[model samples]
Target chain A: MHRVRLGIVGCGIAARELHFPALVQLTDKFEITAVTSRRRERAEDFASMVKDALGYEPAVFDSYEELLESGSVDAVDLTLPIELNVPFIFKAVEKGVHVICEKPISTDIENGKKVVELSTNTDKVIYIAENYRHDFRFNKIRAFIDENTIGRPIFVAWHLWIGMDKSNKYVQTEWRQRPKHIGGFLSDGGVHHIAALRVIFGDIAWVSGVTKRVSDYLGDDDTLSTVFEFNSGVVGNYTVSYAVSGKQYFEIVGTDGRIYLDEERITVRGQREETINIPNQNTFKNEFEDFYRVVKHGEPNILGHPVDALKDLSFFEAAIKSKDTRIEIEDLLRSTTPD
Target chain B: MHRVRLGIVGCGIAARELHFPALVQLTDKFEITAVTSRRRERAEDFASMVKDALGYEPAVFDSYEELLESGSVDAVDLTLPIELNVPFIFKAVEKGVHVICEKPISTDIENGKKVVELSTNTDKVIYIAENYRHDFRFNKIRAFIDENTIGRPIFVAWHLWIGMDKSNKYVQTEWRQRPKHIGGFLSDGGVHHIAALRVIFGDIAWVSGVTKRVSDYLGDDDTLSTVFEFNSGVVGNYTVSYAVSGKQYFEIVGTDGRIYLDEERITVRGQREETINIPNQNTFKNEFEDFYRVVKHGEPNILGHPVDALKDLSFFEAAIKSKDTRIEIEDLLRSTTPD
Candidate 1:
């Protein structure tokens, strides 16, 4: 199979720490032939980092439009901020370039719907880069439930709390300090977790939650706790915050068994019990391969299409609304649009 | 310490398994001088069990009223079912016997309020048996937060899921099979957990939750998930069910650290990460001792007076109401009366 030539857009933390390293590992699947950033120095630095890692310096573009015009790659990995990424998808689609955008295709339903519409019309693939869906533990857990290793799934609970002082260094950036959108603290990270649930369980039929930013130091609401009802009759809970002590894990309560995952470990407790340290694989590698299947094999988008991705945003949308309206989650999420 | 004589009323599972043994442990501070049960056979069996366990045979009364009239003890441990317990509380209080009744002073706010008012007017101590307050790990966790070892508390999350099929033997009985009151699924157990949080954290000022009885076999609303706002400005989440996998624990998220407790284990993660296996002690022993302090030394009830226990009910009361009315928890719980 021919390598899928790719353009890495935005030399931000996500791109540097996540996608770049994954690209280095997927040398057989992806050729990162072009790169772009708003600042020339950032792009040059990313290129040098790539050279140090992969022993190659690919083309660098002053602007994303220039990269698209150069015809250096077949697909663009849009790693820019939420507001900036949607329009780039339109540009990539207009140029007939397949696109792999980060989670939450858009902050609002209107634009999110537009992305769905665009992807529907194009033969080129539009895959939302949802790495959690590709994680081995999540997949194994999902498979376990399907195989009746846990009987019928009943409840799902995921909780996380990490203080800003102890959070990722990117949390210190100016743009991130003030989220321009709804989900708050773990805004996009919220989308990622929701994606994981959708992958492991099924579509969320309803959701009820509360969101808060008790600290003035934070620009966006940094705390959220939500209860989710799956279309398959499973009830799930998720709580995340950037203003409390750190905890990162989730538990799925099933009829015949139970499963717990903390990214690094998978625990299944039921008629029998087993705890295994999950073997790590570059999730980005799995995400990109899935995208390639959609492009080359004419395979369906397995991670999530733009529409399925809306449910993740849908949960937090209702969460923000619930904080003010005090409305029941089922009522809030009853309408398809997560407005 | 002068031993405080006690008359135990009701020979049910809880009274027999819990309080009877607890009374034996606090023999230095108290003695089970008399006992009563509706069925003479049950009372006789308890007397024999007490003889075997504590090496003493207490007097047995055919009726609680007879035990009260005889003045065989200073206080009575009321352990009847929820509906029956309130009137007996009144009977015990009116008879001028100090009382150590069970948690959830009453199911309905009207009766619950009456218990509170009666306790207020009397000089005799009325201590609700909230054993969680006496739990070693729970108290230690609370003390850690008070000492600023975990900084200011920000969030609390407790979740439990136990399938009805695998639940306690009492679940097989008629009344439990069809809950007679609010706080669906395991109502008494629900009240117990809420009581535990009140012990470990603080009074839940406002609570918002969604509870459902997705299963038919369970008598009460077999599932509950609630978010609580403490008067201290801390937010907590609790998800519990008797229709799913079994888990029982809570997490206290503070600014500097976090504490996770699952009955037998206490995990503190923060500037330092520590997971300690806490040896389980008889929580009921500490509970009775605290009551002994109240009656023997005129100390104020530390875990809660009747009025304080009402707040725990008020949370579930609102929880039950939230299902149909779609009312905000803060609004539903704003008034002292759970209307």
Candidate 2:
């Protein structure tokens, strides 16, 4: 019956398009108590929008620390750009505030390890908002696999290709094109597939990959091909390309059948083929609802726990290292010391 | 229409399971005039089965050369073990007989090139029987791509895994376990996927691969992971493993949509997703029918030509070389010289 007061950092596209809409929809469960942005004008504009949209007024801050220090807020949603986001997560955790941070979790292993270490000492929850797992279509794929509809997955092939809107001014201004800011495509985008793979195939033991810069205009790579060996002994290959021109699709191949998920539907094929139309469930809304349920009831398995986030961060770090050194990622995962 | 008289060499599982049954069903278009095997009893048994199955009598030969020299057969179906099959194909082409050899076409570059050269001089057709292209589901995928349902393909990820059958008598055989006989797993089983890739994504310009023999008892590799770059700038990652305990499946990812095909059906996903139930059309039967059509009428553009077979053979050869030297495969189509 009690509502959790929330603070949101980063008033960018993700916050504007996903978090704002989701927070407005889950009004009964969560109250948007505070908002912050690097730019004070944007923060004021967002606060006004939230006031008009959700019918409540909350404190607005020009900095994340101000929002974290605000006594009215229960949790912080760190949707800030990666370079700022990593340090912000550590600060929020140290302040004894539960944090739900956007993914990659941290762009590199050192910072990621620090976040993991910080979570162990803190009673406040640290959850990574990896919405792909919460996305109902992908959840159905995991469900079908667990129910033995596919009868023990032996191979998983994922293809994610999202075209950039060249005409969008916001995209042109974003830090996504810079390796220093985003850790390149594999770290930012590939982490989703890696996290999804972990959820579907279990622990990944080793990986090998090649990253290539397709266009001279971008300093970082837009394409990647990676192979992963799961602890279950199943091998998976993933192809991620920002240069590719279309929608996303994925397939999970198992002993008895296969499950194919795309933009619009999910299909399971075995002794008989069945196609299921997935109704448009706003994944961001679902993710926030799950987060709300977990926080309200002390449920540990909602959204993705800190440990799950750490694993995905580890894999992302490993992929970047493998690409950089041109060494098999198996070496990185098995190494006793940091590369 | 004049029926094409056919002779089958090797009388092995391929002949018994695929070729013989296909010939029986298409009796109006094909006539089985002779059969041969290394063992006289096996040859006699096949000849009897062909006669009983089609209600037509065919001569039995103890030696392959005897069948080739018989002068009664118009074409030779080389369905023997891959090693014997390669040499038989060369001899068949030398005898000016059209050939439909079960794949790999030949295990090594030297023999495969020889078959290609022999085909150029003789007016007889040489089809490698790459049945996956003829597979109804793949054809549907091709149609979807042609229709621009998925738009232009930018990346393709294929997973082909066949579990080693413990009870399979063929595994007990010696040649299959030896690298020289079948060129290991990449050349033996992987050729099918590689050939399929060529059919979907143009000619491969280069490839980099890692191969591993997971089972200590097996002399040949059970797993192979490869990345190929096609001439059209489309890049692909392929994983072919006999070590994985599961079924076979593949997907073609394009800019606008995707087509995923497995054992049971084909699913095309674009702005929307639709699953097309493939009624278990026998790929071998369809392949033979195409071969029958090519022989009776003429080679059509879509139903694979001799050049396509040669290109597939070249890619297989390059994959083997790349695996052995740990080098990237380059310029397969241009080189007439064998490695």
What lDDT does each candidate get?
A: 0.75, 0.70
lDDT per residue (tens digit) for residues B163-214 in model 2? 6764555566566766574446667766677676766666776565556565
**Model 1 C-alpha lDDT versus the unseen true structure:** 0.75
Question: Can you list the residue pairs that collide in candidate 1?
Answer: B161-B245, B184-B221, B185-B220, B185-B221
Where is the poorest 10-residue window by lDDT in model 2 chain B?
A: B327-336
- Model 1, A239-318: lDDT tens per residue? 88876646586777776777888757888887668788999689987888788888777898967588667656766665
lDDT of 1 by residue, B2-86 (tens): 9888888888887888887788777798888899888888988988988998888999999989999998888998887777767
Best prediction by lDDT: 1
Interface RMSD of 1: 14.1
TM-score of chain B of 1: 0.89
